[model samples]
Target: MTDDAGLLEETAEDLFEDAPCGYLTTRLDGTIVRVNRTFETWTGLRRVELLGRRRFQDLLAPGGRIYHETHYAPLLRMQGSVREIALELVRADGSRLAALVNSTLVTDASGRPRVIKTTVFDATDRRGYEQELLRARRREQEIAQHLQRSLLSGDLPATDGLEVAVAYRPAVAGIEVGGDWYDAFWLDDGESVGFVVGDVVGRGLEAAATMGQLRSALRALASTGLQPGPLLDALDGYARRHGVGQMTTLAYAELRLRTRRLRLACAGHPPPVLVAPGARPELLGEGRSLPLDAHAVRSARAEATLTLPAGAGVLLYTDGLIERRGRSLSDGLDRLLAEVASQDDQAPAALAPAVVHALHDPGHADDVCLLAVRIR
Candidate 1:
């Protein structure tokens, strides 16, 4: 052979044998026929012991072996190639090494399958780092869930002739808490009850913290016997001065048991629904203004009042319930009123969940809260 030809052949062989990644050729059934030097080095096994003796899958862990049989082999045969398969390989010392593998099926002259060529990349460091990230993410979600529960934990006010119930659901996206909150508590007079449904502007841990602060603020303000309009005024002032729930939308209502009277105010919030005895259910959209802290100089928020005659109920919910994508607000509102009218005879506790569940869209990623109050 010419000296230049010998040099070129030697260089080609050296490159194949010493490549950083492992390379191997196996029979159609995965029996190893040719393996590069890098493969032997990574497995810590001698070529004499592997050639004609072991199959490629023999070095895989049990789960990876199953994957090879069920997925890898079939995919390669069908697609003629498969890429980036995650698997674990058992080395000579029985320790498992994380690997990413790719394979191509070589065909014979008549296009029949002949052999398989595979390349393996070590992924120990990458797999470990990915696992660590997942663990940290899971830990964060757990902490947020705990915090969300603690902030929302409380019982609704109970009294004679007056019933209140709430249905609170986080966004459908799993493993995370959202900013939607509902609260029902008694004012200082103990004869009047407060109903609130608020949606903060953001989500996650910070949103939970903000929701807690706003909830506490509402409870404290309700203790002072402020009317719904003035109460929202106070809350807007709080949001502006404290910078906590800026642009937060909420509905506030005070229901007096003796008079069966309800006064409600809305700030950039959906109007509350009123279901009257022998009358149709409809939304009270008159009291709404812009959400809190929406302008540099906020204007006075309006409030509406109505006597809750016997068998009348009020329903308040966040926009997540009736503000679906591609659907008009009027349409959603009509749907809500129709559902409530159909089921108005049900008790408040049962009615609240049933109405919200009927309108819930699993594909929507927002919190849903429903507060229903009935005066007997």
Candidate 2:
């Protein structure tokens, strides 16, 4: 060879010997024919121990060896090459190292298989980074749960003649706290009681904060002997006064035990469900009224009526309970009614948890809140 050719060959050999990645050449029968110094160092095996005595599959971890024999080797033989794929290799002391492997089949001049060439990249750093990211995400979810608990305490006030039960579930399992809330309390007159269930428009801290503010305002106003409609008007005024224009849906009701009746109002919210003894669930207070903050000086009114002798339960829920992508609101309500009809007794306290569970889809992308009240 000429001097320049000799120099080029020497440079190539040096590069192959000390390259950052592991490299190997094996005969058709899977015996290692040649291996770079980097491969020898990575596996902690000497060149003599690796070259004719070991096969490439022998360096793989157990699972990797099985995968190579079953899928990778056959694929390489058929396709001539395989690109970067994650795998693990066994070290001399039986420890494993994460790696990305690339392999190709080499053919001789007679068109017969001669050798298999492979390159392996150390992926330990990348794997470590991925694990750290997953840990950080779990920590963030933990913090979010803490914040949710702080925002919405799990305490509901007891009211006379009302058996109230609430169930709140976020669409995401790890995040159960949401902006949906239920409240019940005796009005100042002590002759009447008020209950409200509402949903703030988003999720997380901001939505929960808004929910707390609205709930507090509603309770304060409802306690003043104001009827359901006027109370909601006052709430709308508060929303306007505070420049809180975010959309909210709510159903509020005042019960007069002496009259055996309830005054209900809906503000761009789902109708309250009334389940009577041996009867199908029916939607109450379906009047059209704009949601709070939809317009200044809104003229929303409460629909007042007496409960039937067979009065059993009332259910109020956020859209999450019945809303689904591509499904109409009426259809969702129909599904909820079907579920309610199938149940015996149909008391709010009994059906609330079941409804929440039935509506919760692990793949659902929205939050849900349900409040049920059964009166004897």
Candidate 3:
């Protein structure tokens, strides 16, 4: 060979040996046939012990071995290549190395499968970053939870011959908290009480914060003796001026104990369930309007009124209680009505959780907030 050709050959060999990533050639069945010095250096396993003795899949963690059999091997054969599969390698010391792997199926002259060539990049730094992110997300979720608890902490208005209760549950499947909230407070008139359940749009810390702001605003507005409809109207202006909680939905109601009069208004919220003595549970599907701050031009919101008999009850809740993927809203509503009907005789405290437990789907990715009030 010419001297320059020998120099080029030597350079190529050195490059393969000292490359930044691990390189290996294995038989179609994963028996290691050849490996670079970098692979030996990274795994603390000498080439002599690896070549022809250890299979490539044997070097992986147990879970990765299963993944290799189920996904990696199948895809490599079918597609002739696979890229960026994350896995963990079991090193000689029994420690783990996170790796991003790429592999190609080598074929013979007639396109028959012959061998597999693989490259692995050390993902320790990337793995560490991802772990730190998860930890940070968990910490933020805890903080938002604390904030949510503090914002929701308070007593519902209960007087003689009146009972009030509430239940709140966050989502089960995600790292971020949701924006569902509930409240009940006595109006200026001692005989009347105001209560609400609302869902602010969005998630995480900002959603919780928006829920707090809207909850406080609604309470403040309700204290002015404003009825539910006008109260929501004022709340819409507050949200627009403050640029928060736009498109939020809530059900607000006032119950007068002396007269047993019930008035409710919905701002693009789910209808409240009404339970009266000697009657089947039914939806109060009136007094509905658009969600808060939904339109550029504001109009007067609507309110519905009804006279409740003694021993009647009302349920106000966020949509999370009933909504599920692939399920119609009316179906959810129907299920909720059925659940409420089953708990007809229960008091507000017992009924709140009973209805929630019955309707809350563990796999649903949303927060649920329910408020129940009964007049004795």
Among these predictions, the greatest lDDT belongs to 3
Q: Estimate each model's TM-score.
A: 0.86, 0.69, 0.84
Report the C-alpha lDDT of model 1 over 164-242, residue by residue, as the tens digit.
8888878877567888888888788878888899999887778888999999999898888788888888988998989
Q: Number of the top candidate by TM-score? A: 1
As for candidate 3, its clashing pairs are none
Superposed model 3: Cα runs more than 4 Å off: 1-12, 61-79, 90-96, 109-112, 167-175, 188-191, 322-335, 342-344, 357-364
- The residue pairs in collision within model 1 are none
**Could you give candidate 3's per-residue lDDT for residues 1-376 as a string of tens digits?**
6988977766778899889999999999999999999998898999899889999999998889999999999999899999999999999999999999999999989999999999999999999999999899888889898898898898777777899999888788967878888888888888898888989899989999999999889989988989999999999999999999999999999999989899899999999999888888899999999999999888999999999978999999999999999999999999988888787456989998888888889989888888989998
TM-score quality measure for candidate 3: 0.84
Is 2 or 3 the stronger prediction by TM-score? 3
lDDT of 2 by residue, 81-145 (tens): 88877788888888888888999998989878778999989999998898899898777666656
lDDT for model 3, on a 0 to 1 scale?
0.91
- Candidate 2: residue 342 Cα off by (Å): 3.7
Q: CA lDDT, every prediction?
A: 0.88, 0.78, 0.91
